[model samples]
Target: MLNQANHDTDDAAPLDMLEAYFAAHGWEHSRSDEEIVASVKGSWTTYELRALWREEDGVLQLLAFPDIKVTDDRRAGVYEAIGLVNEQLWLGHFELWSSSGTLLYRHAALVDGGEEAELSLSAAELIVDSAVDECERFYPVFQFVLWGGKSPKEALAAALIETQGEA
Candidate 1:
């Protein structure tokens, strides 16, 4: 559920509200008519976040790209890793751009009342935060596959190992 505090009640566009949210958080972002691109630093890497609002479909899509680039040789392993990682995610799924071999997290939300409804600021925050959190959590798995030469299952297992107490 979205918080009601910053609900859009005026003529402000959804992306406009999102721009304000990004500004309030001091996130470096640029906004156009329907899209906003922001840079957010995660635990493992800096992520490029792109948000696109489609007014006709009442859908807002968010994509987070990690700093790592997948080469042709690593594509197969990365694809398998993405499947394993996506299975454990609830909000968004990881995708590899076939042409560029770039990995990204993608998620979409629908405005309840179609054209009559607006996306809340809290909702936007939730989407962005969730993507970053998931990226941070699973970043190591991709590395394991690409750099460590580990299988998808092995990479997932290694990344999921829980550590106890403070280091």
Candidate 2:
């Protein structure tokens, strides 16, 4: 029997557990046996992320591909700057898809030791939210590298500086 209280579905499968979690939060989503895909609109771009339920590893892998794809000439610069950005992020990391030159954000959450019902909402929330937030926050740094001809260090510096309210 499944714990109906924690999950929206009557069954307690891993995929159902995740689907129910997202649905509870009123997030628009689609799910299959292997993965759940959700669309999130970030500050700079709209992205679609997929969360795959890895039953064998007891991991939920989440990934988001940003709208901007690096051109052939700028791949080296984008690749270098992403390393700097990845260093600062606590959860999830950005990478350029080598074949397509598309920027992607990736993360994973572990749920191996415990039962599916033990999976808290916050864990799922953290994985997805962090990916979305990072995508929105660092997108411009990549743009600066591509268009402005800014060095990785310079772009990163500008991205990290906080702005104050107008006097």
Candidate 3:
């Protein structure tokens, strides 16, 4: 049962760390199961939902099972992996909170022409509100955007991987 009562102020450090790791090792979103499910329903077939991606070092790391969706922003569908020209991009999307969480406050090349579409501030705000509500009573959230455009890994890594002065 996927409840909507969890997801709040997420840990910025770890998420950033993960982003860096992913940057060094490229990771991305997988394709849609909808196409296959379109023809069948209730028929149990073993399928793994993953983001078929390659590592920065040119190594292919196939994570068998992954969590990807297009539901409400707070419901984990917020982080979507769409394809654009010559690259796979992670949506400038989010999973934030009422108080605080992972809201792409300032988008820097957040969109990659075709891969990432423009998500209005209104929509972004909605995601923050909903995610905050989800984890309001529980604990803070844990967000991690794996990939995006060119040098996406590096930029994300820089954002997350803490420095001396900045947290």
Candidate 4:
């Protein structure tokens, strides 16, 4: 069980599971927030930034596929923030539903790559704060920051939710 106020767990839960999964399949990729943001800087447009679906071989796929690593301890908070940021971006009602029916409203921020990452501290905070301010405008839930670069949780959580999502 998880307390609403805090998600204090002894283990990273989904992170540990996803880490093993990625390592087994060789899909793990690591980069600081800076590296990711930089990769997408010039390429980031409104559609790209708030993409709800992914294209594979020109085929449209759900947003929840494609393994993405997320840092742990920030799971719940991060998804909550995604919703906030979505609203901020005016992307419309975006939500990701897990198989267990645990509805998670989130956004997929694809951080590209570059030197900009090494020199930008405020950009990192801006990424998070902007989401919070936007989501706070409508939803009361505090933001959850499951940073994939910082923790392995994002990939793990996504995988688990997918198992249940298909149900």
Candidate 2 weakest lDDT stretch, 10 residues: 1-10
- What overall lDDT goes with each candidate model? 0.85, 0.78, 0.25, 0.30
What ranges in model 4 sit over 4 Å off?
A: 1-88, 91-93, 114-119, 140-167
Per-residue alpha-carbon lDDT of model 1 for 63-98, expressed as tens digits?
A: 999988999988989999999899999998999999
**Candidate 2 — number of clashing residue pairs?**
0
Model 1 ranges off by over 4 Å: 1-12, 113-116
lDDT of 2 by residue, 10-120 (tens): 435556666766676566799887888877666787788788877777887889888888889899889889999999999888988888888888987777654453355
The prediction achieving the highest TM-score against the true structure is: 1
**Which one wins by TM-score: 3 or 4?**
4
Give candidate 2 misplaced runs (Cα > 4 Å).
1-14, 24-26, 113-118
Question: Would you list the clashing residue pairs of candidate 2?
Answer: none
Top-lDDT candidate index: 1
Error of 1 at 54 (Å): 0.6
Candidate 3 deviant stretches above 4 angstroms: 1-116, 138-167
TM-score of 1: 0.89
**Candidate 3 local lDDT, 1-167, one digit each (tens):** 11123222222222222232223323332233211111101112222311222222222122211122223443332332111101322322222333432322111222222322233333323332332232221111122233223232343344344457855
lDDT of 4 by residue, 112-150 (tens): 232111212233234333433333332222211332342
Between candidates 1 and 3, the TM-score winner: 1
